[model samples]
Target: MAVSGVLGVFKDLDTAIAGVDALNELGYTRADFEVLTNAPYPEGTFGEEHGMHRLGLFPLVGAACGFSVGLLITGATQMAFPLVTGGKPLFSIPPMIIIMYEGTLLAAVIFTVIGLLFESRLPRLGSNLYDPRITAGYIGLLLHAPAEKVSEAAAALRRAGAEDVILEEQPAPAAAKAPQRKGASA
Candidate 1:
């Protein structure tokens, strides 16, 4: 099914909040629309439902994997080539503690960064509901609605004092690539 998106630009935060409320009244759920702003705003600042995220698990899983890898590397190296120093026994705990600690910290930091990017929906591939005015301190409320409801959604946004509304039709499905002709240019 074809879908269309609308972006309602507002110059004031209050009007933007009203735009969100207007969309809500038009039978649009929080998931169907997103608020865009240039500055950081607390979640649910506009009374939108807080999105659930699983960022907390990333660090824990990374730490566990790092600890396991560290343990394996230390143990396997010691077991593979036995080295006697100061007549001490192999698989020494004191030295292994340092490597394991460092490994755990490194992996945890890496995973936290990964989780942050994932949670923030980075690299938005084909988002068409964006307006440059948003970067100029204007707030944008992007709404994804069925093709039939595009006008209705735009009207609702206008009622809420939207300064301008931008509409975009979702791209059609990609067509199959044309087959190369025999003896094509090298």
Candidate 2:
């Protein structure tokens, strides 16, 4: 039982910010709304706008794990089969550093990509609320409002110079229901 409402698109960031500010004055907090921009904007551009919290930390932690594994493998091999070259020690520190560095970076990049995909909820066929026009240098402000307040929110957006207002419906779940059989006992 959730719904999303879309305000008219704005051609510039300034208009977007102004609309957000107006919404705030009307008692709409950051948690109840989101702004979609075609280009990156500075943090806090919309008077306390909050960005999505990232899950990038997973990749960094994974990289540390990889580095430790690499170091253990390299060191153990050298110890198991000691190679004596003149007066040099059987295990060397300089060569091991290089292997550890490469392994750590490789693992970090792999995990970061995986984390990005997981966080984004990707591979979806479609989204119910999307406007192709927003991709063409337009910014969209989406608000979550009670059913009774949708019109009021849309009016506020229009007053702040929204080009158009529209109601968006969430897509119905795609599960198929079994057909009921006539005269069949429960």
Candidate 3:
């Protein structure tokens, strides 16, 4: 479904919350809208009926998996290539413990960073529906409404003290190109 929308910019969280409440009172549902803020606001303040914040969870899970994998790799390597030193055990627990700890921590950090990047959809080279004012501490409430309801939605936002109501257009998808063959001359 071609999703068209309007974004209502507000000066602060309070104004944004008020605007969302007004829209809710005007028969707008939570599924039809989203709120973006520079800093996180309290849940339910902007008529956000669902507690759906899951961005942080990705890094935690990634870290756990990374730690497990790192431990397994260290243990397997130690078993496969035994190194006997002056009266030292072939598979020394103390030294191996240090290696395993470092590897596990490294993996956790790497995976967490990767997870954060993936979850945020970062490194996007294309433009997206965004307002510069949002970075200047303005809260933005974006509504995905029917084209016919655009005007009404904007009006509702204005009535609720929105500083600016702007229609956000989706950027056309870029055409896919064929991949070049490996080892081709530059």
Each candidate structure's count of clashing pairs: 0, 0, 0
* lDDT score, candidate 1, position 184: 9
Q: Which of the two candidates, 1 or 2, achieves a greater lDDT against the reference?
A: 1
Model 3, residue 98: C-alpha shift (Å) = 0.9
Ranking of all predicted structures according to TM-score, beginning with the best and ending with the worst: 1, 2, 3
Candidate 3 or 1, higher TM-score: 1
The local distance difference test score of each candidate is: 0.79, 0.69, 0.69
Estimate, for each residue in 74-182, the C-alpha lDDT of model 2 and write its tens digit: 8998899898766678898777898888888888888888888888666533323444557788887777777667778888887887766666554423432321111
Off by over 4 Å in 2: 49-56, 121-127, 171-186
Candidate 3 stretches with Cα past 4 Å from truth are 49-74, 81-92, 123-127, 169-186
Candidate 1 lowest-lDDT run of ten: 177-186
**Clashes in model 3: which pairs?**
none
Give the lDDT of residue 114 in candidate 2. 86
List TM-scores for all candidates, in order: 0.81, 0.78, 0.71
At residue 99, give the lDDT of candidate 2: 86
Model 1, runs deviating above 4 Å? 81-89, 169-186
Backbone clashes, candidate 1: 0
How many angstroms is residue 181 displaced in model 2 relative to the true structure, after the best TM-score fit? 39
lDDT of 3 by residue, 35-55 (tens): 877877666676666566566
Query: Which window of ten consecutive residues has the lowest lDDT sum in model 3?
Result: 177-186
lDDT of 1 by residue, 1-186 (tens): 667778888999999999999998988888888888999799888776676669989999889988888888888888998998678898787778888888888899899999989986665544445667788899988877888898898988988999988777445224323211111010
